[model samples]
Target: MATATTHGARDHARAQEGNRADAMPVVPASAWPDPPCAAGHLVWAETVAGGGSTHRVLARGTELRLTDLTGDACAHLLLFAADRPWERLNTADTVKVQWNAYLGEHRLLLSGQGRVLASVTADTSGRHDALCGTSTLVRNSRRYGDGSPQSGSPAGRELFKLAAAKNGLSARDLPPSLSFFQGVTVREDGTLEFTGSVGPGGSVTLRAEQDVTVLLANVPHPLDPRTAYVSGPLEVLAWRAAPTAPGDPLWEATPEGRRAFLNTAGFLASRGIA
Candidate 1:
């Protein structure tokens, strides 16, 4: 007879313990109120602990939302085209092409080829950074004494390395990352000022303009002046949604953005990707 506390993988319900698969999406309605889409539409959901990392391949039109559950969760993000590994997120072009330093809704995350990889579809947390990038092993070790993924103070780059490898990518594929929730400001002297994250429950959402592999690390912002390695929980939710269309308002927001969208559409069409 099986005990109430224990059960086999193929147990026939004799045990009363709570069990679930490793890859099960949480109940959408129970997870969060007012989700962008209905429960059935939700495709992915997970809560990454402080100083943790996550990776996922999102299909075109998927909407991913990252929430600062404790207000200090810094989401370091990297993106790569699912089909074409060479086409990766280019933070420099993302900033240079847009000619905007700050990020908000409707900002298209572009690739080096000037095509849209993802776009900021919704944002309640206005603070974001594309300049300082993520914490490195050297920086973390100097500041917190340990920089490995198992350490209390893990380097964002190292974490991303491990996540990237899971997707057949290497350190070279890990391009400069983008950080959300933690931000910076430019001083008059052209130096950077760390405007650390504040306020809880702030969330930012992005829509996949093309199939993309997203890698992330929820580590402390590199510029975070705090000596202690303070990390927080980050909630991730993704759902199926409609991809951008030619008539979308964002398509007409700017000439540069319009061009990027066109380029992305052309590529998708050429590949017969829907």
Candidate 2:
């Protein structure tokens, strides 16, 4: 005996109540993994500003987490053997040895000497660019006009030079660096295209296999088409991690991964490190 209009009005009221329930605030969860070490036992932690840089010496078994505090950020990174600075990350070698152009979780970052420098144990931002190198002053000036370290428009290359100098390196020592969180794809015609792939709270964790010097620059990707030179802050956290064991994700990722781990283990054994 209820009219159709009355039923319609009741339904509408119910829908409105549902919408209000859905809009209620919920606590946000962390995108990063819990610290490998106990709480308050981190070796170091810092937040690098946009267009800024940092350098550090990471010992073997050290776990470093890089988090994009905001979305659409790029971190240009380079690595070198602390003892032998000449041996550094080789992008071509890493790509060729892995038999893949895409770098994500479980990929080993190899040095030019065919040894493992670091292993990507976990990655939320699945895509990283290794083809296009870091941006240079000349390239930045041509794209964004007035690319000068003094003007606070420091390019990735300039940042690396300054970071390296602090560790007794020179401009000539700079090598091609890996740009994290910047997605690059291969087109049908063999051309490379850049795309946005990371969002706020996305992160990547790297576990060092050898004593290495890490250089990082928070800068825009060379292929970033944005007219504004906006970069975002990145949070870095380092801690001691447990030793890698057999059947680990990184160890069983590929045959090459196992081989690289063996090589690194041999190197460490020679140095009297377990």
Candidate 3:
């Protein structure tokens, strides 16, 4: 038989224990380190504004990190082999090879020829969109009633087209892109829904497996249902990384990863890059 006073004390003690447990330090998923390059030596860095785009050529063994400076940022990215421009990233192959519909960390960006183009080495925003493509000028104009680059509301396709022209590529060369920091969910009826999951300071690091030309558009996803067209800026950082070792995590992520890496390695070796 316990008294009311004893019962109250026990309840208080349990509450305190729960409070202490809640106070324990918990690390966020996005608390990843910067690229493994020299602390002060950055190859390139820039802040891409919403509805804007940028492109750059990255050498093999180099890593590029994209940080969401503001929450709700989306970066649509396309990768092409620098040497062989025809060999570009294939989103279908990338997802099919890994047997995963969702892209995340440790996934290799596979080229059209089943070769590794780049690898997602580190990712703070785990949910990236592979199915929903970028928004287009016509689509945006129809949706928002204003999709002019001059009006400062260019669509993702418009930005991608401009970026492609800078690299001497044409609209026909533009393929499907991966939308980083944007998440999509599939309903029971096979309908896709856009979901925001990234926060400020969340970042994703991609390690190039070959000399790759990257085209990125900081724009709202096509399925983004925000009425006001809220797209945030993205911080880009590029740094040189060490050569991939035999025990690299990307290579060991899956059987498909190993195969794609070997294909890429063989291609490079044939080109006298051994």
Q: lDDT winner among the candidates?
A: 1
lDDT values of the candidates? 0.88, 0.82, 0.81
Candidate 2 deviant stretches above 4 angstroms: 1-36
TM-score, every prediction? 0.89, 0.84, 0.84
Estimate candidate 1's alpha-carbon lDDT, on a 0 to 1 scale.
0.88
* Tens digits of lDDT, candidate 1, 31-87: 645566876787777788889998899999999999999888999999999979899
Candidate with more favorable, higher TM-score: 1 or 3: 1
Which residue pairs collide in model 3, if any? Answer: none
Query: Largest TM-score belongs to which candidate?
Result: 1
**Model 2 alpha-carbon miss at residue 211, Å:** 1.1
Q: What is the per-residue lDDT of model 2 for residues 11-122, given as tens digits with 9 covering 90 to 100?
A: 7667665242211111111222464567655665667877888888988888888888887668889999998899899999999999988888888899988889998888
Higher-scoring candidate on lDDT, 2 or 3: 2
For model 2 the local lDDT of residue 43 reads 68
Error of 1 at 269 (Å): 0.8
The C-alpha local distance difference test score for the whole of candidate 3 amounts to 0.81
lDDT for 169 (candidate 1): 92
